[model samples]
Target: MWSGPPQPDEGLPTGLSAVSVPWKNLGPSKGHRESPGSLVENPASRKEAQGEEHSAAAPLDVSRLRSSSMEIREKGSEFLKEELYKAQKELKLKDEECERLCKVRAQLEQELEELTASLFQEAHKMVREANMKQAASEKQLKEAWGKIDMLQAEVTALKTLVITSTPASPNRELHPQLLSPTKAGPRKGHSRHKSTSSSLCPVVCPTAGHIPTPDKDGKELSALVRAAVEDNTLTIEPVASQTLPTVKVPTVECNNINTCALSGLARTCHHRIRLGDSESHYYISPSSRARITAVCNFFTYIRYIQQGLVRQDAEPMFWEIMRLRKGMSLAKLGFFPQEA
Candidate 1:
């Protein structure tokens, strides 16, 4: 009902209005500049006046303000620097991980390429044939070899003969039975067997009891006498056991190495890689042939336990064996990768 004019906003002291005015007037409206001496009576009075004026207005918090502002600035700068350093470190770690992954990917790709190539298989074959006929090709090969060895031995023996011995005519045969088999019966438990292989047989002279004092031409005595085997086949046998030189041999026992099973193991692993064995094809690639030698030489770092003959040849293969040990699922060939 008393809405004559709109009142100012409330929530103030009852007697005070929202819009206020300073009622106390110091002088007339005409402005004038005062002398410095009149404005400040003395240093103490001026300071007291300034202090009272400051107190009358509002309290200003100056203590520790500049120091706190400086501290805050320093803390903010330090935090920014720490954040920047952390970001840089994280970026570096990410880069390193990416590089490692790239290298691994390259290696994997190479292995995949190799695995996709052609497959290979290791082959083995064995055959046995005892009887040999003069009409067969194998017989011709044996005959030629036997003749060569016999001729060489005869030449060597002839070199030792004195010039005083009787000479034979060119038409006469120096050894009549050189091409014929011995007619004497074989001794018990000592039989001969002719091999169908093209390998050469060693030459053996007759026993001391059958040696003649002088040479004979086309004589009735047999030059060589050997027993027959159970199969009625003839084979030349040396008086003593000896190792013959062989070509393209899979392995050789030498330098105090009694067995070369290590070589067999390496070959088997190579074959497995050539085949489609996934683990072998990927990990045991062809290039590993040369790499394994270097790696195996460093195997002195570990102590090894062995079961059979220990050989220098096995040093490299033993390390490979330890890595590719036999599992329950599968095993390598009996002659090769199993434990060569």
Candidate 2:
């Protein structure tokens, strides 16, 4: 073929006439017909093209997203487990502390109870001792009161006896038969002259002053004595209680014994008579005789007082005692022995 510029369709020669061709016929030949617009050719370009096609056509990867979510969940579970372990450990420590405190409280309570019981026991013992002492003191007080009451009653009885026995008869006289034993006998030089006789007599009268008056004749005194014997005013008894031990007492038969006879014939003479004798030595009932002797002894005391044997201040008491004893003898029939 000649290589030249082609003619237009309207001006082409007959040998070289323009042909009518199909649109497919415009493409290159098999080797060269691969136009860039028609078919893919470069390998990099094909891969790019394939990737774009996959992107457009493929579905989402749901399995990969699910695996990633599982990994995150496992990490959160481990964190929560660590926090739970810390909380459990704290709770255990708190429970142990609470138990220890409870034990300590129990021990304290037990000690307190023991102390309280001991104190109560001590208090009970003290109260019992005090009660016992109070009872003992009360008993002693009652006994002392009883003794005082008895002493008062005894004193009252004695006073009543003294008051009841005071008033006496106005007329009473000594009996001849009751005269002193000395009068029945003769004096020392006259023992050869007389014979003596004795008899018992009874007289009852109140105790009072019935002293014999100064009179030459014994007739009035004798009549009064007879009246006194009849009156029965004097009553003699053994002392109610014996103050002195071992002594004889005058008998009822001796009641009429004439106390005035002890003064001898001269009424002023104080010498008492002994049995059947004018002399002083021969006596029955020696103790009674001694008391009578003591009255005679009073004259000596009076003499000694004048000689100042006793102090001047004490002399009055001696005279008063002597006078009282003399009076008492007239009343009581027996003498109270005067102290030396």
lDDT of 1 by residue, 1-340 (tens): 1113223435434443332223233342357656676546555654454445445433232334566789999999999999999999999999999999999999999988776652221111112222333347676886676677666544533332213223222111222211111222333332333341122222112221232222222121111111111111211111111221211211221111111112311121221111111111111222232233223222211212231122246677666556544321122222223322
lDDT of 2 by residue, 1-340 (tens): 1124323345333333332221222446677746675554544654454455445433333444566678888988998999899989899999999999999999999999999999899998998888888888887876666556545533532332223233322111232322231222223332311222222222221122223333323455334323422332211212111111111122212222333432323221122222221121111132343443344334434544554444457667667766756754753465445423
Off by over 4 Å in 2: 1-64, 151-340
In order, candidate lDDTs are 0.33, 0.40
In model 1, the runs with Cα more than 4 Å from the true position are 1-63, 119-340
The candidate scoring highest on TM-score is 2
Itemize residue pairs with steric clashes in candidate 2.
173-225, 205-233, 205-234, 206-233, 206-234
